[model samples]
Target chain A: MPKASAKKSAKPVEELSYEEALTELEGLVASLEDEQNPLEDSMRLFERGQALVAHCSALLESAQLKVQKLSGESLIPFEEESE
Target chain B: MQPTLFSSIHLTVSQLTLHIRKQLENDPTLQDVWVEGEISNLSRPASGHVYFTLKDKNASLRCMMWKPDAARLRVNLQDGMAIEAHGRITVYEPQGTYQLAVNLIQPKGEGALYQEFLRLKAMLESEGLFAPERKRPIHQLPNKIGIVTSQTGAALRDMLNTLRRRLPLAQVILAPSPVQGVEAPPALVKGIQLLNYQLPDVIIIARGGGSIEDLWAFNDERVVRAVAESKAPVICGVGHETDFTLCDFAADLRAPTPTAAAELATPITILDLSSDLLSARTRLTSLTLNLLAEQKAVISSFISRLKYISPERRIQSAYQHLDELSRRAFSALTHGIQIQISNVNGISKRLLSLNPEGILSRGYAIITRKDDHMVVSKVSQAFGKMKVRVSDGEFEVNRGLDTAAVIE
Candidate 1:
């Protein structure tokens, strides 16, 4: 009964901070690059890595916007002026 | 008193300078004097010294704020921050003029100037100039880079060399302009607008380090506005690490120096890109190999199972089944034959039992005349010329001489 209850109540892992997620993603990348882990473990890591990547991407997107606002400008293509 | 002319002359250079300094220090009018004027020709030297001219409508006096006093002032000293300085007027013999040696300086309240900066900032911000959503992302690998700096300065050269070294494929377009003085602001603004029209992937606004006065053009409202309004992502690399300008804030990115700007603008080398591609290819190949290995393992397992089942045993089982079928077939055939034979024997026995001859052998016979096979039983028939078959043998029948004829 205890085992069944544990299985029924199991929740997904908590969301990580941007730095944590990025670190995890880097670790996943390194592990994948090494190619030494078992297939099942690798698949698990890949799933986690996908989540981390999404988190990092969101963080970067927001950070870029904040920087742009602070800088008070639109960062766009350069245009030239005529003499 | 008339006899000693040297004594009458009386004062050495140091003594005269000290006397003047002490007198000015004690003078009540010169001390704590409030002078309202336009500031001009402000100079901050390497030795942490400040020299500027404070002028009224008619005349101007040279003022000096040594490093310690200037450093103590809270507000930034600009060419036009109308300020009141508490100082004494003293004569320097070499200059032959009495100047203000300032001890304390404070702003006269930057009401109009500060308000203008705020107003412009708010106007641009309300127009979505400062909106994060409007800012464009810098390209990871820009094919073309535009630089807005003086053509003669080290800034342009640094950026060019960096681009060449890091990203050889990148084409650099130099939008040369003056980087200092009054002309710099207009030139920079025009350069930015021009670059916007040209539409380069990325632009760098850069300048070497200088005094605040020298770098003032970058702080101009026009230059800041232009930078903020640029269509291209502008990177401001104006001066050393310690220096900052309005352009830096308005720019999409800021680098510590021209070299750092180059580094930020283009960091990836072709070698790195190729190495990344190669690594990706290797990863794909490894994944494929692993998948193939798993498939091979499954196939080998199936083969082993097939081998373990034993083909010879399967054939032997088939042979045993065939033998069992043959035995059943033979037994069925024998049983059918026996049934048929028994049926035939029963029919023959019934036929033998039914036969009249068989009855005769049982001590019974059908009596008949010798000439015919008809059965006769009455004596009258026996009197007529009848031959009869008895159980023992055949007999001929004879008519008796009638006593009845003698009697008639």
Candidate 2:
């Protein structure tokens, strides 16, 4: 758990991995949320945030619910009628 | 062959005893009774009837139970020992004496079955089957979920409904078993073993509330051992919230009810998570637009500096075009993530009217009187030849003298 931060510190927000996107996006959100920075800087960060979010969403969409149970063999889908 | 009753004013002893016996049999309250007391003066007659006096400190009652009822006695009864007896009260005909016709008897304190339950509990608990440190945390994103329970039980239905409502996408498969009676313990053990072979991310063993005997299967030593040894984390949702069993202790997690267990096992749906991404996308687009407007303001202010410095015009042009291209790309990306937003493009188009030059791009003209150089908002304000500004350049429009006055 402690190593998570050590690894994250080595990485930049723009080049974040899929698991780190949510945290980076949330941090960017908090930073930009006040509208304090000049428009150009905020805009640059916002585009980066968008790219990161899109990558994270793609990962989520790829996962599907996989169902299996013990039959005579180890684990098989429940829809198998012969069981 | 003894007696005939021929009485003018009174009944004989036998006739009176018969009347008492009939009264005792007719009373409904005495028909089926459960009495708790110490037994005394016990005797077994050759006829297979067991006779005993059931006595508390102050009172004693004669009890006689037939052989068939006596044969079913789960615990042996002896004189001067406390027992709970079930029987009906009846009066003997010849003696006119009332006695309890005993049907069932068990030791008064914690019957044999309950005693066995306590013994198993103590043994398992001493073996550290219930240690909290041994519990495994349930997996956060397990796709496959297994449940070991009777398929026909209400617990199964509740679990299914909860899983469907909270996260219909989570996969749940059942290993069916009987959750009650003497034969239930082994069935439950078999189900758990089968489920373990599959190694689901998590397993839930569930049953509805019942008496101690009904829940005995969950407390069975074999079932408890299986839960403790399984590679997958186990959740025991046996009986109601108040009900507790050894399985609950041995399993990795204990839930108050089956539905609560289901909710814990599944995570939120993908759609719910994607909505967050949608919101982030919106913020990104709006930020880009805000930056563009800010930079426009900054450049207009720097226009005065152009008199002192000759800026490199060629490089400046290329940079401006690159910024514009990036803006267009950002807008396209915004549209791709448009599932959560409706008519966002229309809003952006409306924002164009906020800038004076942008409205001209839509083929609208701004007219001003050349003499006063004041802008005209209404069409009626059009007087003599007016300077009308369209998108590209300026032009003069000639108006008739009565054009402004003709209406009024």
lDDT per residue as tens, model 1, B155-240: 76676667766766566666778999778899888888776665778888999987556677877878988988888898889989
Give the range of the ten consecutive residues with the poorest summed lDDT in model 1 chain B.
B399-408
lDDT of 2 by residue, B98-202 (tens): 899999887775466667877888998899888888999998755568898876778887887776565554677678789997778888888887877766889
> If scored against the real structure, what TM-score would every candidate get?
0.44, 0.46
C-alpha RMSD over true interface residues, model 1: 10.5
Candidate number 1, chain A TM-score: 0.53
Index of the highest-DockQ prediction? 2
On the 0 to 100 scale, the lDDT of residue B369 in model 2 is 88
lDDT of every predicted structure (CA atoms) = 0.69, 0.77
CAPRI verdict (incorrect, acceptable, medium, high) for model 2:
acceptable
Error of 1 at B35 (Å): 8.2
CAPRI quality band, candidate 1: incorrect
Top-scoring candidate (lDDT):
2
lDDT value, candidate 1, whole model: 0.69
